[model samples]
Every structure is written in structure tokens, then in C-alpha cells.
Target: MEQATLQTPLGMATILGDRNGIRAIRVTDHSEGEDSIPPALAEACGQLREYFNGERTVFDLPLAPEGTDFQQTVWQALLGIPYGKTISYMDLAKQLGDPAAIRAVAAANGKNPLWIVIPCHRVIGSDGSLTGYAGGIHRKKWLLNHESANPQQSLF
Candidate 1:
């Protein structure tokens, strides 16, 4: 599979995929960008950069995230969530025609392979507090704040 690790405001986002589509995009700390970027990953890499630069709000890429059918459904539903918006797990569950599936929905959300692209960070506790994220709660906060329409101004 084609691969590339690029630096971003969150961290080193390691993207893995090939001509079929993007398989995964995960963020980690203090890693170097790949010395050689694969041709297949050029567009995905470029799009991610644009997202961080606030030049792009929506992603258009051939994504091939591997997960169960239910998980796939959850991820697709996640895409419906607009940029700079938040959705409670309850709302997400209700949208899927299963209000009782909140835990199942949240579980599937946690397993989302595509990070920022999937916008799982937009899902929060029903009370509006940031909830658990595979990338850590702190990273979730940073991501939400980054995409905020009314961005919090620095006290400095």
C-alpha cells in the first residue's frame, strides 16, 4: 500500500493507502514526515494540508476505510455532520433509526479509521462536553476548537 506521514497542527498524520483508496489517516506525536511521498497519496496529503490551513472544509477523496457493515454505516452518517458542527451520540443514534444503539454507535465511532476526514471528533457527550476519542480527549478538544466557527481568541 502507498504510504506517507506528514506534519500537521495536531501531529504527524500517517496516511496509508494505494490506488484503491485511502485506508487510514492517524495522528501521532513528534514524528518526521516521510522523506518520499507515494504518488497514490498525493491528493489525500494535499487535501489534509488544505484542511489544516482552513482553505478547505470538506474532503473529496477515494476513501476505503475497513470496518464492519454497521461501522461503515456509522462512518457514513458521520459525514452528514457539517463542518464546525457538533452532534450528540443520541442524535446520531436517532438518525440511524436506533435511539437505543447509542453505545453501539459510540463504539463504532471510536473505531473510525479515518480521523479528521471522518470527523468523529465532532461527536460529543449529550451534555456538550468532549467525549472519548481514539486520538485522546485533548486532541479531540484541539480539533473541535480548530474547526469552531467562533474560534476562541487567545488571551495573549
Candidate 2:
């Protein structure tokens, strides 16, 4: 698998994938040395940069995140969430046809590896509050604020 690390405004982010598609995009401590970036990873980095710059809202890159069938299902549902919108965990579970699966859905959501790419940050608490996030609540707030202020616009 190929990998590339970037210093995003939020922090350091690493992209990992191969010819299949992008597998993961996670924030991590800065890694040493400059690794050669694969084409797909390069493209992912560019798009992420555009996203941070507020010049882009929607992403159109191939993704191949690794997870279980259930987790995969939850991740796919997350993608369906429109840009600049937020949904509660209960709402997400209901969308998956199992309102009782809120906890399970939250667990799967927590395991999302694609980070900003999968748009997991769009998920929030049922109380309309920003909750747990692997990238920290501060980053989550930033992402939500960013999206709310810079929603996708039609080219037409």
C-alpha cells in the first residue's frame, strides 16, 4: 500500500491506499522523511488541501476503506449525508433501519478510518451537541463550522 502524510490546518494527516482506492485518511504526528506519493494519494492530498482552503466542498475521489460489513454499511450511509449538514446518531441508526442500533452505529462511526473523506464529522449527538470524535471535538467543531460557512455551490 502507498502512503503520504500532509500538514493540514487541523494537524498532520496521512493518506494510505493503492491502485484499488484510498483506504484511510487519519490525523497523526508528523512522520520523518519524505515518502514518494502515489498518484491516487497525491490526488487525495490535493483534494484535501482544496477542502481546507474552502475552495471545495464535495469530494469525488475513489475510496476503499477497510471495515466489517456493518461498519462498511454505516460508513456508506455517512457518505449519503449532504455536505454542510449534520445528523444525530439516532437519526443515523434510523436511517440504517434500526433505531435501536444507535450505540452500534455510533461504535461503527467511531471506527470510521476515512476521516474527512467519509464525512464522519457530520455526525453529532441527539441533543444537537458535538460529541466524541477521534480527531477531537475541537476539530469536529472546526469541520462543522467550516462546512456551515462554506457549503457546496453550483457551478452553473
Clashing residue pairs for model 1: none
What ranges in model 1 sit over 4 Å off? none
The whole-model lDDT of each prediction reads 0.93, 0.89
**Candidate of highest lDDT:** 1
Least lDDT summed over 10 consecutive residues: which range in candidate 1?
29-38
Q: Write model 2 residue lDDT over 19-51, tens digit each, in one string.
A: 789998888656555456778688888899899
- How many clashing pairs does model 2 include? 0
CA displacement after TM-score superposition, residue 45 of candidate 2 (Å)? 0.7
- Candidate 2 wrongly placed segments (more than 4 Å): 29-36, 150-156
Clash count per candidate = 0, 0
TM-score of predicted model 2?
0.90
C-alpha lDDT of residue 152 in model 1:
82
For candidate 1, the C-alpha RMSD (Å) to the true structure equals 1.0
Global Cα lDDT for candidate 1: 0.93
